[model samples]
Target: MRGGVNMSGWAGFSDEELRRMQRKGAEQRPAESGSCPAPGPRKAASSAPRSRQQLQRERALQQAAQRSRAAGEEALQAGQQLSEPPPERTSPGAPEQTAGPGAPSPRPEVKQSPAAESEESREEAPEVKELDRQEAEEVLRTRLQVLQQQQSLMEEQNRVKKDLLTRTLQLKSQQTQAEAAMLKTVRAELQQLETMATNDISILRGRIEEADWEYSKARKRYERAEAEFVSSKLDLHRKAELKEHLAEHLYAIIQQKELRKARKLEELMLRLALREEEREAGPAVETQLEAENVETVKEADFEKEAGTEEGAGSKKEAESPEL
Candidate 1:
């Protein structure tokens, strides 16, 4: 089992998948064993075109290497424990093994001393620790690169959002201005119509009064005369003409007023819709990121405080004398 791979979790996997995973795990063994030379610097994911799966595989490789290293350490420890001398099983009164009369004395014991074995283990520890450190650094580097890329993307998105917001605001302002202008125009037309209506009413009132006077005079003249006079007929015709003119003018003014009011309302509604849309679509991506950044800074400050406390505890322990 020492050199064998654990393919225990291959329940739903095909042979091809199993073989590939095994092959990849094996490829990472040399790095894990600390027999291979140090890995050179690697490219960050941001700088080069790397598939997502490839980066995932690299992370998997590092994890597998770490597991292999841990397993190797466990095996080494087991071997050390096994190497320890077993307890003797002699009876309390039993004698030590005596060399036979003709048997030559056993060669002097030349087994490795405990101190030498410990020293060897100590020497091996650093080598394993160094490999673990390297693997950790590599993993952190990849993660840092991913974070940097994510930050850049977020910044770009924020910039785009800002530009869009600016455009919307400009458009809203333009729409507002247009609506105001149209309102002003409509207001002016309404004022003009009102003035015209006033003038027409005054003119119609004067004409009606004049016609009434004329009709009265015509009736008087007609009454005074034995027969209806021609002059009386002319006054009646003039009165009828004024009434027709007043009615036509009033109808035209009413139509114009209705049309202008409808147009103004439509424009007002359009402007309101635009404003509502702009309001609903939030325009504060940068602000939100800023808040997130503030939270991150606060978290970092807390982490630093914890780290300082840990260091202070370690220092206190170092200063204190052992009992």
Candidate 2:
């Protein structure tokens, strides 16, 4: 019984142990089955998807950068292609494109608005701006100098014109004075000529009056001489007639005296003859008587004859001869 009891006990111990073991096994198995496998692969797959998305983003960024570099190169090449060559040199007064040796090439003319110029100036280096300002100041100085020179030239020209005008006025005044003097001299000369003419007229009048008086005196003397000549001729004719009458009267008286003398001579001859005859015949007594008688008769005749002759002679002498 002991053996059986021991064996039963052993079997019972063994069954109990087996039942605990099974329960532990069941618990361990359920526990082991309840714990699932870890989800590492799913996590890894999610992470891989996220990593690919990020790689795609990185490749897009790289492509954009490569395109930007290519465009920048194309722009640089285009800018170089569009740029023009330098312009040719030109002669003075010629077109800008004209070619010439040793001449400066034309530069591009840049026109800027106010805003653009301000921006460019701001962008310029400090040294370059300083140089440009100095150049501008020099240009202003040159312009000022030229203006001063022009003003001086104008003033000089004005002074010269004023001097010429003054000289011209002086010359005109002198000429006027000279003309006035000439007129005065001419007037004086004319006055002198008039005076001389008046004096000459007076002298001529006096000479004419004297000539008239002398002519009147000469005419009167000529008339007097003519009257005297006519009276003298008449007196000479009367004297010639008186002389002829006186000569005729004297011839007649001489003829009468000659006749008386002839008669007396005849009587004396007769008396003498008678006396001679008586003496021849007669005596001496008769001769004495005759002589006495003849004496007495002769005395009486002489006295009477003498008285008659004296009377005749006195009458003839009383008439004087005309011549």
Candidate 3:
């Protein structure tokens, strides 16, 4: 019965008392709630230095925030000081009072709290930055469009220049071909002219040869006529000499005939003279003869008578006387 009663008293102890007991136990066991249990004394010393470094970093951030608040309050006070002036008065009939040194200094206007001003500035800054960004984007887009237009214009200009060059070359080639054809035609005309000139020269040479042959024939005929004329003159001179000789011979023959006829007439006159003389001489001779005969007869009779016959003769004489 005594052991049971002691056990109940220990179980019924107060919570505060129990906590005190736990604290005591912790102190005795070398550990606290907010601290790590150290394996040894050296580890506990290392943890204490790390906790001091953390506390110093937190204090630095708090002091920076307080300085920013002080600077913002000073700027607000300076702006308010210049906004308001003291009250003034004017009397009727009195010269208007000019602003003077007697006037009260201006009261500073109340400014907004630091927290409100900071929030407003922050809001305005974001709006200005957005507007600048939009302007820059617009400028970039305009520049890109201008560059594209310039490229298209350059391509069109190149196409136009290429087409012009091609047309010029084609025209030049056509001109060259036309010039060549014209030159060919001129050369052909020149060749034809040369052939005609050669033919004309040959014909002229033939005409000259024919004229030379005719001249030679005419010269031969003239020479033959001249020879005939010379022969006729020589024959005429011979005939004149023959006629002179014949006339001289005929004159000589007529003189010889006249001399012979004169000789014959002289012979006939001599014959007639001879015949007349013979007739006259013949009668005289006859008378002489008769006388002689008478004489002779007488003589003869005388002789006869002288002889015996003389007688007879005398007789005959006598007979005759009788008759």
Candidate 4:
């Protein structure tokens, strides 16, 4: 039969009551066994051995608790795995053993020893804290990895944006330069065409002015020539009329000279008859007849000279423009 109390009976007990019960049982064990009066040598020998054994057990338990506490502290600071095994939980139905039958029975108010309960609690507490530290460390590591991945992705996006911006600026600059060159070329061509048109207009205007001057000069020359021709025609008509009048006068003078010649011839015939009759009469009658013949010839020559001068003067007037 087990000489002990049940662990279920210790569940509702306070620590002070349990410790008081343990002291009472320890004091009563030696007296009830009648071994308290053992011979001095034997008692000294047995008590020394028992005291050493109890001290060893107590030191062992304290060392175990300290090691567990230290291990838990180190695990919390460094996130390392626990090397010690997990603590075992005591069942409430299990029995607790006493040293002998002479030991005092426990009081109704006492159930379990305070030292054992404390050792169990001390061992179990570290295990719980270590598990919690491990979970927290795992969560922190996961969050750090996610943050690093996001930073790398953002850097890549920025690089792509910068490259596109640079390309756009280059294309814009090239287009602007091309437009400027095209505009310059067009302006130059327009200026050249305008200059050519101006020159052509100037030449045409000069040619027209020269043509007008030549036409005016020709008209003036034509007018002067016409005036000269009209004056010459009028002079010619006047000269023709003067020539007709001079011809009529010359014909009348010639007829009168011919009649005078016929009359002189008849008078010469009468003088010749008279000369034949007076030839036998005397020499003085012949000399007076010769003198009369010379006087009549002189008168006829003077009249012929006057008529020739008038005819020559009329011919000169008819031929000259001054008439």
Task: Give the per-residue lDDT of model 2 (tens digit) for 1-323.
Answer: 11111111010112232344345445544544565433663344345555543443333332222222233333354543222222222111222221122222222334546676565443322323223333234323433544465568778988998998999989998999999999999999999999999999899989888887887787777677666556555545554554454445444444543443344334433444465555553543365356446654754565466557656654544442322
| Highest-scoring model, lDDT | 4
For model 4, residues 17-43, the per-residue Cα lDDT tens digits are 334434544554444455333365444
Q: Cα deviation in Å at residue 58, candidate 2?
A: 57
Structural RMSD, model 1: 60.3
Kindly report which residue stretches of model 2 are placed more than 4 angstroms away from their true locations once superposed: 1-162, 230-323
Query: Which number leads on TM-score?
Result: 4
Error of 3 at 107 (Å): 47
Candidate 1, residue 140: Cα displacement in angstroms equals 3.0
The per-model lDDT (C-alpha) reads: 0.50, 0.45, 0.45, 0.53
For candidate 2, give the lDDT of residue 168: 92
Q: Against the correct fold, how does model 2 do in TM-score?
A: 0.30
lDDT of 1 by residue, 10-68 (tens): 11222343345445445555555755433331223234344642443343343343333
Residue 209 lDDT, candidate 1, scale 0-100: 100
**Tens-digit per-residue lDDT, 136-254, candidate 3:** 34324433444455567778888888888888888988998999999999999999999999999999989989988998898888788787667656555554554455446445544
* Candidate 3 lDDT trough over 10 residues, lowest sum: 1-10
Structural similarity to truth (TM-score) of each candidate: 0.31, 0.30, 0.30, 0.36
Give lDDT: candidate 1, residue 172. Answer: 100
